[model samples]
Target: MRLTVLGCSGSVTGPDSPASGYLVTAPDAPPLVVDFGGGVLGALQRHANPNDVTVLLSHLHADHCLDVPGLLVWRRYGPEPAAERALLYGPEDAALRLGTASAEVGGECDDVSDTLEVRGWVDREPVKFGELSVTPFKVFHPPQSYGLRVVDSAGAVLAYSGDTGACSAVEELAQGADVFLCEASWTHDPGNRPVGVHLSGTEAGEVARRAGVGQLLLTHIPPWTSREDVLAEARAAFDGPVRAVNASESFDVVKSGSAVRRQTS
Candidate 1:
């Protein structure tokens, strides 16, 4: 299994990176694109065909799903006609919200049913995608949100915390994962942050430590926060390796003994 960082900026697009997007691919299977945020469709096109992948959104935040309309545009009017409707998984309102956003007329919801087969994810139930099994766990966040645990046929686990503050559900989703792609959107200073919307570096580290994950790939960092400071804070709480992931960076999932880790790609 391979994991690709398409974008990692938090909240909004930054000078160097887009908002939040990721890609997970397995041999001979269709790639799964997670969170197609702003500027992601263009970046994703550089790595894989837009029409040949499945999309999963952690939430409907603009930074997490705004580029979905771009994808719909490509699939609907690109050079070659779409072979079939691609799968789209997210919250119950995904189709309505995204369809409306992609509509040509003002206040009209485009019938996206022609472009993507939309499905709402039920928390804790594992959905099969070729050789991969994805289980989503409800997490603490505005509106609706989930963290995911993806297991490939090889048993290599990849867990993503999505966007959430510290919660037991986040830790449960990440339990024993090989690579925990967690969001660390703020510094550790409580005096400078708000509550219940996002996780600080220290809180993200605690989740990694409690979950006993093999490696921590911190992501969703905003431009204003210092990467060095966040990484240092995470490192203090997690004994294992913790690295801040950047756009276009890739990791090859590998297993050793009973542990799973990624070789830098």
Candidate 2:
């Protein structure tokens, strides 16, 4: 499977990137988009038809899922609209949160049933989409959030941390995966930041080291945060390959015949 970085900015849209968003795709399967935050819809249009993909949100935070409502517009009113309702998976309250955000009138959620088939994710239960199986793992975040472990028919695994703090669940989600796309929102300054919110680059690398993941890809670095600072922190913690991913970069993920790790830029 191929993973594309549509956006990696944290908390809010940054000057150089959008909020958190990633595109995962494979042969003959519909594109699976994770965390459709701001600017993702526009970025996705560059690679695939916006109406021909499945969406999965990690949480209801505005930076992680605000673009979903924009997607509804394209699928419903674009030049070539969707032929059928597309599937969207998120936390249990996904329907309510998305609908409320799309609402035009005050205190009313616009009915998104017109173009989206919203589904709630059950923790650890894998949802099959053709050749891919997506298992959502509960993570530390506001409202409801998850870390997705995607496996292809070839048994190649791609794990995403999806904006989590230092938690054992995040390590479990990334255990022995090929590419661990984890978040490192800021520098390693515990006293300066709040806990149970986001992981530092040091924490992200520790998770990768403990889980024995193949490659560690740090993401969700806000524009204000020094990229080099976080990169140094991760490298100091993990001797394995660790890269600070950027917007529009793509990675080809594979396995050595099984669930062993192998990746290419």
In terms of lDDT, which candidate is strongest?
1
Q: What is the lDDT of residue 48 in candidate 1?
A: 94
Q: After superposition, how far is residue 70 of candidate 1 from its true place, in Å?
A: 0.7
Q: Model 1: runs farther than 4 Å from truth?
A: 257-265
Clashes of 1: 0
lDDT score for candidate 2 against the true structure: 0.89
Clashing pairs in 1: none
Give the poorly placed runs of model 2, Cα more than 4 Å off: 257-265
lDDT tens digits, residue span 1-265, model 2: 8899899998889888889899999996789999999999988888889989999999889999999999999998899999999999998888888899999997998889989999999999999988989999999986778999999988888999997888888999899898899999999988999987899989988998999888889899988888899999999998888988878888888884233233433
Error of 1 at 110 (Å): 1.3
